[model samples]
Target: MKTSRILAAALLAVGSGLALHAANAQQAGLHRTDLLQQDIGLPGREAIQVRVDFDGGAVSIKHSHPGEEVAYVLEGSLEYQLEGRAPVTLNAGEALFIPAGVAHVARNVGSGKASELATYIVEKGSPLVVPAE
Candidate 1:
């Protein structure tokens, strides 16, 4: 009986975590599909790649990662606002590097759909994305 109870509690905790993650993703307004995640050569670090799509006029919530990010535009134009820097716009075939822990937001500034291939090099065992204040 005790083992069953423990298993039930573990499942409940995992379920609750998933629910919170889904809620936050919906609030961000951007659709992200993770492509790959693996440990890098660097000690205690990892690399993650994701493709993010945004609807026309959609904006991503301000957030930061545990490490640096390299974003390559894959479709329509996108405007990025990074903390302490002027906003910049990029079109297909362009790319930008965002410093670690820098708060940033991306918006679909064009009239149609937009997408980006975002690659992150981050500390291992940490959350991939954290909302900025």
Candidate 2:
């Protein structure tokens, strides 16, 4: 009887361990993914972050996972200033790339409110704006 009880206990322990493993796997854990900046409502989208700073630049930020971000100046010219790099200017139908984790800011140098559209494919669970000092 003692031997049978010991065998049953061992089985129960193993079963519990498997249950825990399965539970952990079922939890929401982000992985490498391709995220379009637009919110087209396709599927499996975590978040779609789009911002339009009309002729007004915001505080430049950095990130952890490093992203490949590209911007298209739609309305007017944009002066993109980056850390440790020369400032670049782009006009309508022009585009620029901001490398991963590099501090950068954009300003509309052209008259009127300049508009630009940027898209990014970021690693899952990583924020769009990772603060940089």
Candidate 3:
């Protein structure tokens, strides 16, 4: 029946829209690799290093670290945005420091892949990073 065909078409359209949205959402985050983590010999303190790779047009969700975080751009460029501050564009060899509990987002604003080395100094047994609601 025409009614049945119309219903199927509507469902298909909705399904396609959902699929596209999911794909875009997945593309909005950079790939992170845990490089190293070790105790800093201080009580309950630790250091962690991570390598993050961002494909062209990729971005990171709003997130925060348990303690201070420093990031050095390895290649390409990034747009770093922090709460209560203007966004900053960082190029290769540049670095940025993010204070504890500050929500921020990083994006690859260039036409190629961007890479960075992120180091975190945080309390042991605590998560290195956490997503902000």
Which residue runs of candidate 3 sit more than 4 Å off their true CA positions? 1-29
Ranking by TM-score: 1, 3, 2
Candidate 2 residue pairs in backbone clash:
none
lDDT of 3: 0.85
Work out the TM-score per prediction. Answer: 0.83, 0.56, 0.77
| Best of the candidates, lDDT | 1
TM-score of 2: 0.56
Compared with the true structure, what per-residue lDDT tens digits does model 3 show for residues 24-117? 3554556777688889978888899988899899888788887899999999999999999999999999999999999999999988999999
Error of 2 at 107 (Å): 1.0
Q: After superposition, how far is residue 53 of candidate 1 from its true place, in Å?
A: 0.4
lDDT of 3 at 4: 100
lDDT of predicted model 2:
0.57
**lDDT value, residue 21 of candidate 1:** 77
**Cα error of candidate 3 at position 46, Å:** 0.4
- Clash totals for all models, in order? 0, 0, 0
